[model samples]
Target: MGLLAVPQPYDFERSLDRFTFWGVDRANVWYEGGLHRVVDGREVRITPAEGGVEVEPFDEAIAPVVRKLLGLEFDLPPFFAFAQRDPVLADAVRLLPGFRPPLAPDPFEALVSSITAQQVSLHSAYAVRSRFIDRFGVAFEHAVAFPTRERVARAEEQELTALGFSRRKAEYVLGIARADLDFDELDTLPDDEVEARLTSLRGLGEWSADWFLARHLARPHAWPAGDLGLRKAVLAFYPDVTDVRAAGVRFDPFQNLSAHYLLAALRYR
Candidate 1:
């Protein structure tokens, strides 16, 4: 075990709280305990250190994964500077200082999560996803690894439906798993190209693709304009904005981070 330093102004507790929200806890993401599952097949535990968070088993190898998961790659100075210009976002920035947007370490997991979230409350989505993971994921002492594409691909649509996915959603999940979509290749593609490719797949649409960009690729401007929570948050925070897309335009290149802060504001409100 080793300790890795977190970036300045990174609130480990707040970040964990957001990650573990909506009963979406997983063995791989133990927010309360600060343990995360890394792609290199290791579990790292994070805790607050003097000026940063300490990670156990802090092999430099897993540093990138840690940074990605915690949104440490983002330079907040620019975002904070931009936030000060908007009243609603200014208040959000004040209320949720040091809150960085969290990322999905796995793009496949992010897509599956987006598919599960469609037309359902977050609580419901989390329940269904938990059931799906419990049924297919590998379990360890502390956390369960997310099911691989191969595992999910092998499952029948009926199996997914039985696990609480709607019939359409089950087909969608099955389609994605079976599709030859290259998850790894997406990293090299621009946002528009990625969205176009993803939307071409069955059951994937602009909404899912947008979230994949936001949560998986961590694209700074990726905005899910159709998200109900985002719409509600925009309405509550920016009353004059009847159109979410217009509000998104106002945020411009930082719309993704703005969306996250808005969601956090709604939670803390």
Candidate 2:
């Protein structure tokens, strides 16, 4: 019989709390006993335990991350109102009970990951990234550590491509690593200046830069004008999503939160 163990250390819920706009589809958590992140895929399963929750797939540590993400405790104005009548969106999100994803907190990794994800399937991206990480990243037991510049800088372009990364992505990753400026320096700059610097990389685009800010830096107003999901979700709902610069107006100030709202909303249909 399984002995009851107190949920300790790992906290997925708390991690989820800080991000109001999480790409976390609880189903996407790669659970092989240890918590992992899966791209563009989602799976959810939970069973009862003697003293606590017996969650399948998720590791003990994942609980806090889940709670943190589901930290939307008190209802906000429009969000509260919106949740009241919208059954579709509500149904998809109701299970969370309390979710509050923190703003983006990993600018470098976020940017790099987004670049790898361009026009690719989620699992493919995850697979490619897993290999890249296994090769270049140092072992990180406490939490996932972002790859070091030296590791990335030292890698050959072909090696990355062989791992499913496109030449363009490989170059971009190397370019970023090789650049004199990095997160330490970039963090000191203002948001616009930081974005400008990152955009200077070979494969980086305006959209990718914005994604870095919105997802990793937690820029309140960060918006991705070129996002396919934003456009599709907008068109699917408001129908004015193709308005380009103005397309971002739908969720201006809280564009980051808006992404979450849109995703939560889209999950309805």
Best by lDDT: 1
Off by over 4 Å in 1: 27-32
Q: In model 2, what is the error at residue 21, expressed in angstroms?
A: 15
How accurate locally, in lDDT, is each candidate? 0.82, 0.56
lDDT of 2 at 191: 77
Tens digit per residue, CA lDDT, model 2, 1-269 = 12223232223443343211333322233233333332112222333244433443464455443333233222335554555454533553453443344432345566677877788766566667656766775443222334667778888999889888888888888888787776757656777997888877777888888777766665667677678776676667665445845866545555665565565456434
Model 1 over residues 54-110: C-alpha lDDT tens digits?
Answer: 777776677777778878767778988999998888999889877877788787888
Best by TM-score: 1
Model 1 residue 195 CA deviation in Å: 0.7
TM-score against truth, every candidate: 0.94, 0.66
Q: In order, what is each prediction's RMSD in angstroms?
A: 1.7, 8.0
